[model samples]
Target: MPAVTVSNPLALPRLPEPGLDARPRPVLAVTTAPSGVEGEGFPVRRAFAGVNQSHLDPFIMMDQMGEVDYQAGEPKGTPWHPHRGFETVTYIIDGTFVHQDSHGGGGVITDGDTQWMTAGSGLLHIETPPESLVMSGGLFHGLQLWVNLPASDKMIKPKYQDIRGGSVKLLASEDGGALVRLIAGGIGGYEGPGITHTPITMTHVSVNPGAQVTLPWRSDFNALAYSLAGSGSAGIERRPFHLGQAVVFGDGDSLTIRADEVQDSRSANFEVVLLGGQPIREPVAWYGPFVMNSHRELQQAMEDFQAGRLGTVPTS
Candidate 1:
């Protein structure tokens, strides 16, 4: 996709191999995402569906939005809606999106840009394609990830961050055969631009054919990998996976991924999104748009939203 790329990944900073003492995480599970329609009928792959919540912990859900090319007048987006007790990270890889929220946060994010919105207490928000994009539709591909906020921060004020593509920290594998786009969190002393309330790391990796990459991970954080395109294998046992699949790893200090020597013609490299976060380990009472610690709290959120305490949608 058109997220971000360099003419020579070899020129980028390299990630050193994990030390001999680093424990290699084992692949716990591999699941294929089910396709679904979302946000006014736009296509999406439910990336985290069917995975056990205990393994997901701090993460609630993820949707891989549109790797499809839209025809003129075919672009779609979400209607204004309310959310509470979590964060929404929308990363645009190949197209454009416009976001606006009642908290006075709004922006247009195009290729490789990210919009991070923390709907902590509550807020009304909407996302759509720009008028121009709707008129001359082209490729649209991206991911929207939902991160849970711990109870302590769940009711804090909402926040927003507009992270541009150029701000991402780029690095390569030790052998220079893979590109790592650090979107948020830290790795080997390099930090990404997006700020988060939870301890987490997000990276997009593209591994060349026959290449292998090993990443040093935080032992305290849970590890996950989702395939965006092409073929690859994960962990010490080399469990194979392809596009639209997600991998969960057992406890360890490192993660290993290897690209197939011969990939399908559609993709040149094995593209994956790596995510890990410190588990919240608290009760998760989640409903349509609200996530809270208890059923009573969820009821309160729904009542508050209906009463417009979340904030009113702005006038055009």
Candidate 2:
């Protein structure tokens, strides 16, 4: 008998704009999820959490919450919780987030701050409180993403990163398009900051109105786009994708994209989340706040927290 060595799924090879002259694929489906949870708090509202859309890539969950009341003394967020089998990435857009952990790491994440938490073996932490943001109502927007971990790496050491917005490279075009990012993974042609434990890429981009941008991608990698700020055109089928939606591109021998800004968004900032990665199609046992491979593993995580053997602190 031979030992079975788990291998990482192939993530899409990131390619630069296909020089704007490549052939394109039409998007097959343009779907939308009207409402979903913002997080542990907030009542169910019209949040564009990427839950209802794309699973084309390793991008599992997306939660975009705004109107997050960041009063100086009041805290609004999830309490001490556990996560395994995946990592959660948070980006603050309007306010700040006070993060603490079981690893003696804690900090105040202000707008543009990026925190990438790898909950490999398992992790118990509290997010929010000691308010990092103070403000009245407007758009306290931000994003939450869950990156799946391969079975072999599920018990790897947990890690965290605080990549400031200014630290991330932002490139702009003469027109309306721009790219801000690289919280993780690499976009070779574009020098982005932040690195990841596994194979993945997360970036924010804008497609100028009526201007088409072609992106080169690998046949093996999974790719998907999220409609964040403005309406736009995307996907292999090249159909219409409105705000608060995500389009998961199908896997084929070709990876092509052609996007033109919608008429109403011609002058608007067509914001979208560009993500691609290898899929860990392993079985997932997800609980309220923790995710493991089986019920027994999840039970161990909870038991560790109760017994205090899971030595980690949420005080970065």
Candidate 3:
């Protein structure tokens, strides 16, 4: 759960506190992620499984990959796959992952690092544990978020960004009760390193026990909070949320999160990922591996992929 951390949060820039008139976001709904197996039989929690698409505009789906400790010879990874009309943001929190793509954009990302891959036109890629990590077998936990590309940019050039842990913009709650790692987008004029086709904000937060954090949010952007560890409450109403639960927030100028006085033994702090994005509000034709604006486009993507127009896996 060490996505990013510091010995003393007070040493960081203090996050802007909400104004007195700030409207607290209301908790609209909460959904507990369902566990299932993903590529190569690795466990994952489907973070957006039961959430409404409208609330997740500009974002397709998210997978909380393994909070598991794999033994030697047990580590697994995804086989080569193709994607188009979207971007994949893979953030590694506890382990190392090696990424390779047909576009020659790939690298090794470990603790607190991120790999942002835009399969704009199309590309073949694979994600796997590094040989060393696979052999040693240790903690592996991360998040993969699918960000949809708007129709106009769906066919643009593909690209990649390797965002290192240290590149994240770190901030502390107004009272220094929480640590925030801004991976992408802006929060109160502070921007992250991730460059995206769609407007969005992605952050990992760690709230100390009994602490509360209030963050100003763009009213036009839909807000969401997914618990990564420990117990906490969301919104000004104090709606309870726990690990693997996704909290959808209603319209407001800001959002709130509170950590329980006593956290579960598994985690020392309440960990959550806050996500928000400007709604694309376009028709989505999403199938396995491809996301498009229309079913016909999805069909074209399949044709292109099968015909090897998406690029072949490198022989090397």
Candidate 4:
């Protein structure tokens, strides 16, 4: 529960590559209304890196949980479950989410807080609406992303990082037209507070109409942008995207996102989550919440969970 501050405030210098400025990354594909499915007990919209298209290396899946309002006393959430061989990044935007894991780690993540949990080996956990929220009835909105672990670090040890909203660095445009929240990795010269096993950048950006920002990224990493709220255009193609939509980018060392028109009246801005990471092109054997390099390893994970070796969560 320590604060993570920006260690550097200057943009990382890039080597001069021919045509780097001239070449803006192009949007490889646009996914709208990615197949919806019920996860645990809550409704979730699978954006990318799911069963159908799991090739986005280092990124396993992204789920946008209920932008829905729940009535008082309604039960809605994921019960106890086990995960291994990866990390789960939960960014809560509006409602209170209480978490408890078998490792005796848990917390309440409300507006703008992020819970980064590494189920490196194995762990059982539950994510649900806080008793207060469930009894009062209110809006709940958030995003959960799964990041893959390299084969070498698959069983390094479980860890957790609970990042508060205020602790995250917010960068504003010189013209005051855009704001970027650096959650993890580096943006320009500023860096987010969350540490990572694999190299990646997680940014939540808000852009006003007619405003645009070009973000430098590692050329070798795969990139994806998810439209969480409002609509916007991205890449050299200036592809138009809407809420619940995800845009996958092709090879490039940088990305440009522009807000063509404001979609929210209250904020008069377009919002998006940009994620990029170095690709781990190793083979994947996935089953339920477990992801391993081979099927045999996945079986071992199941066996461990069944044998009670992963630990147990408190019932109360």
**1-316 in candidate 4: lDDT tens per residue?**
0122223323422222224464567888888756464545666778774323443778988898867777887647787899999999999877888888998897999888999999999899989887787789877778899999999999988999999998887776545566778899986667899999989999887777878777777787778898877778989679998777888888877888888664763335677889988888888898999999999999999999999888786767
Tens digits of per-residue lDDT for model 2, 153-226? 87888888878877765544333244334455555466556676557777766555655445555455667776
Q: Distance (Å) between predicted and true CA of 3, model 3?
A: 4.0
**Compared with the true structure, what per-residue lDDT tens digits does model 3 show for residues 222-276?**
9999998999999989999999999999999999999999998477999999999
**Winner by lDDT:** 3
Better of 2 and 4 by TM-score: 4
Superposition error at 102 for model 1 (Å): 1.2
Worst-scoring 10-residue span by lDDT in model 4: 1-10
Lowest lDDT 10-residue stretch of candidate 1 = 262-271
Question: Which of the two, 3 or 4, has more TM-score?
Answer: 3
Q: Which residue pairs collide, candidate 3?
A: none
Stretches of candidate 4 above 4 Å error? 1-22, 35-40, 49-55, 264-267
At residue 35, give the lDDT of candidate 1: 100
**Winner of 2 and 4 under lDDT:** 4
Candidate 1 lDDT tens digits, 259-296: 99998946699999999999989999999889999999
- Model 3 scores what on Cα lDDT? 0.94
The lDDT-based order of candidates, best leading, equals 3, 1, 4, 2
Q: What's the residue-level lDDT of 248 in candidate 1?
A: 97
- Candidate 4 clash figure, as a count: 3
